[model samples]
Target: SWLLQVGPEGYIVLPSAGTLEVAGRTLADVRLDVLHRLSALFRGVNIDVRLGRPRTFRIYLTGQVKAPGALQVTGSPRVSDILNSAALQDNASRRHIQVVHPDGSRELTDVERFVRIGDQSMNPWLRDGDVLQVPVANEFVWAEGAFGRPGQIELGLNDSLLTLFRLAGDPLPAAEVGNVLMLHWKDPFKPDSTWLRLDDVYRGTTNPPLRDGDRIYVYYIPQYHLQHEATVVGEVERPGTYPIAEGRNRISDLVKAAHGFLPTADLTSIRVHRLNPGAGEKDPELDRLLRLSRDQLTASEYVKLTTKLSSLREDYRIDWARLQESPKDLDLLLKDGDVVRVERLVPSIRIDGEVRHPGILTFQRGLRIQDYVQQAGGFTDRAWASRIRVTRVVTGQTLPARNVRALDPGDFVWIPERPDKTAWDDSREILTALAQVATVLIAIKSVK
Candidate 1:
């Protein structure tokens, strides 16, 4: 076996054997000449002669073909063979396959005619750089609204409503199977629509064929009642709005659906902000106070009235702790537009300095400075009880421990180191030393 190259002059130049002129010779002539020459040199020996490097050409088959691209051919290939290689798509036009030649000339071939009638004229050999385009079928329709898989679906030349419905995955459960609307867009601004009963079409009563650019919208059954939905936010594993089904979908159920609360969630008081339907309704006593003549009352009385009015507008806070204690309250039904927020636990108070087990302790109501000091294993020997301070989180005020009644959340409890002497005692000792030095100076002057 040897490799050979055909020259630009259309002849193969062989190095081992003398060059055989094949410019005008056919492929059979070249093979026969090689075999005869080998047989003459070695008599009664088997010889195998094969042609190599036939003139290669490429042609492109695009649009609605299974695999559209340039196809390389060693020899002239027929249109049927090229189309078979490309594997035309289902929506490809069978009667309008166009072949555009490199010389700007075009030819239309009916592939279906060639396949059925064996018309050799419709299956001409492809030329180099020819572009074969298989256009998509013009009859296509879009199916949207209440269909399982709704989108623009290409249709066959004679596809009916039944075929289009099956392609769109049929009508969904919520779809009104009795009424289906088909809109034909003959004009861009105006579209003609027709209502067809899908139930009738299913029973083989009347199946209408669809045209190109037709849109089929399946209507849904009308819903008269409202569907409830609630949202849960903050300190939960999954926080989002969830639809409340028609059942016992209470606060606990909503919380469980959100994958429960996080570790840092404050179980003490979970806030549920509800929007009341009668929020516009006012209390008679509050309305009376607003209408009262403020100019007739003294300045102090008017201030008291204003304070009472402001307090009346305050939102009521639900005690989640009490609700958690009562089993019946946990099953309380939730309403639509309700926002349940699980607040994060407050940070523990920091207690560092002279103490046996100095660290932070979880905040609790009614915890005092002494209680926190005792919880930290009491104070050390050098602990200065008089210099103990508390930094309040509310006002950000660092005051003496005696001034604070209770330890608030996020408060810093500090105990300073005990001093050996008081400031007044050090000042008195300095004054005594200065007096002794002055007396010593006066006695020396008297001796002089």
Candidate 2:
């Protein structure tokens, strides 16, 4: 007589239908848990099924997408359909549809228009949705330098996609092609990758289908008209002012653009002496030292001199000794307007106190710290061997007597108090005091 019954273990029993137990899965577990808690409160003759399959698909609209956050989709759909249903973008270019596949590859579909309304003979040079554009035809061009062009007419196509005719004015300056620009399209109707030069594009290069919402950019390459004005001085084959184009020139390029340096020229010492714009307001102090003629310097020269002085006080510095030891220092990036002076290397060190020839001796390149000591006259009779210390003035770093480190610029060699080993006890006492002093000095120096 009962249409349905409740089982003790949270299950639904139907007299006509088969028994359905809460199988501890999906809604079953929830139903069982819920019913098990409320079983005593309800004595029901009919069973109620509370849960079933959801009616929505999980979707997330984000980024430039109009609809954002978690969303639900109902029924089968395509990407276009989903976008439309969600109103994803306001200005979405249907022609530029970009679909991201599950495997992460992207599909770019560009829509093109070929045929026009009254097009006959298959619309000679256009496809559907493509706009007809008027072409600019001209047979003459003008530019400067060795040669110039008055006008030149274009003939039928040759093997070349485009041909550049010399314009009348001056012979085309070497490497200076005048007014050549290129236009680029972001999206073309055809699914091929082909580009045309500006001259050709303006001249109706191809009949490729043009699409809606496509963009084109124009780039120009001006001939080096200024080549005759640019000059390379110091260490170059032709060291003088040479002309170059306005923009097609750089220091490095100009170096190669010219014949390069002579065999005697020092490449590392080469520098650009630009016209100093501020040189007219000469400082009396600087002019006295440089003794450069007024005509020889420009405003830029004075400014550079001032800057060099400033750098000499600060950044333009090198602890040649440290640099020699640490090769990394040599890799410093040189800045424009920087005057790199490669002074002749004069190796020398000062040895004070003790030794026979106790004066400053000129040291040669690759001279060691010991060489300087020997030059300082190899210690007086009372000179203490272990008491020697090399003090670096620039870094304030001091090396001990026994440390065989190389001598650096601004370093002073100090030969300390002697250690007399004539008597065993006296020598021991002196050595102990010296060792104690060295240890204390090292410890005190550590905090620095």
Candidate 3:
């Protein structure tokens, strides 16, 4: 043997046995062939051979490939490894890549199968001096509605509806499989549609062949995935989520379904928190007015600001006592995601800020704002008495004491300490109250 080694050209020169082609062939297969030829020449002794280093060579990449030309790869690479080096265009055919061998025989590889289904068989090892022809993809199909991965997919020549659906992931539970809409273009100018039963296709039924630019829409069943439920907690007998028919279910109906309120249920201050209330588009006029100081606002703008604030989603409270008095006018229609919190009876009013003794006072139906303020040691000398506000605990509605005549049991009477507070400070305080109370929309008009 003439100092044999696996050269760049991938062959070994034997003095008497001649040359042998080894590149792209399996190392184990090449080892067997080498040993067989050499064994004939050198007999009566055991022959041992092992690969010292992996072989690397250049492979030609042409057609529908980015940076098309010879791409250098090393060490017994597969079709996928070479593909990684030669980035193919989006229009390149991933399902029918031709790997043309040096001897002119070619093998078809499916990169899509290897990627989507993890089918290793579809990805074959590369041969040296092989030419990869990444043809332009011509077929395409689309899938949408009630599908996990709903989008357009590159199609192969023999790909069927089943193949497209399989690549899209399993249909959602709400998918109306029997009525899956299939739209295709029979006439070049117009499109036609038909329904296919996907369940049958999954079975023994022949999967329909897909045409170019076909669309499959798997629609969802009506109300199949919808959940219309609300929560009832606190002093309610059953504190859990219950389904409601929305418009048909009233506050009383929901309460009755919860096995009525508990004995401690505060009938005078039952609160209903509508979780998903629609917040309308931002009002630029209202926004501009709010940013200005109270003195900067015109009389007409002040009126506008007050009117806009009133139209906002209010703090909703269902007084069982008031509803019982006038059921027709007071009964509220329950909505989805409404939280009916039946608080334990606490016949006490909270008197906070600027009060001599800020604390809870006994609730009396006849007591006015002044009456409660007097019981809580009255306002301090620094108190902004005109700006004193009563915040409805259930609805966070803070109003001037003059606007409120009699106070309820779960009410917060805040007496502000007189200050040269900026509009930003008052606005920030009002925003804090809104977040904490859930729907508090008190006007911050005391800008100094």
Give TM-scores for every candidate, taking all chains together and pairing residue i with residue i.
Answer: 0.39, 0.22, 0.62
lDDT of 3 by residue, 282-335 (tens): 888889989989999999989998888777753477889889999888888888
Better of 1 and 3 by TM-score: 3
Put down candidate 2 lDDT per residue, 71-104, tens digits, no spaces. 5565333344444424534444322334444345
Q: Please give the distance, in angstroms, between residue 119's alpha carbon in candidate 1 and its true position after superposition.
A: 26
Give each model's whole-structure lDDT. Answer: 0.77, 0.45, 0.82
- For each of the candidates, the C-alpha root-mean-square deviation to the true structure, in angstroms, is 17.9, 27.0, 11.9
Full candidate order by lDDT, most accurate first: 3, 1, 2
- lDDT at 267, model 3: 88
What tens-digit string does per-residue lDDT give for candidate 1 at 268-368? 55777776555567766556656778776668767877776555442223345676788585555777777888777776888978878888898888878
Candidate 1, superposed: residue stretches over 4 Å from native? 1-69, 73-132, 136-140, 185-190, 222-248, 252-266, 271-318, 322-347, 350-364, 368-448
lDDT comparing candidate 2 with the true structure: 0.45
Better of 1 and 2 by TM-score: 1
Candidates, ranked, TM-score: 3, 1, 2
RMSD of 2: 27.0
Best candidate (score: TM-score): 3
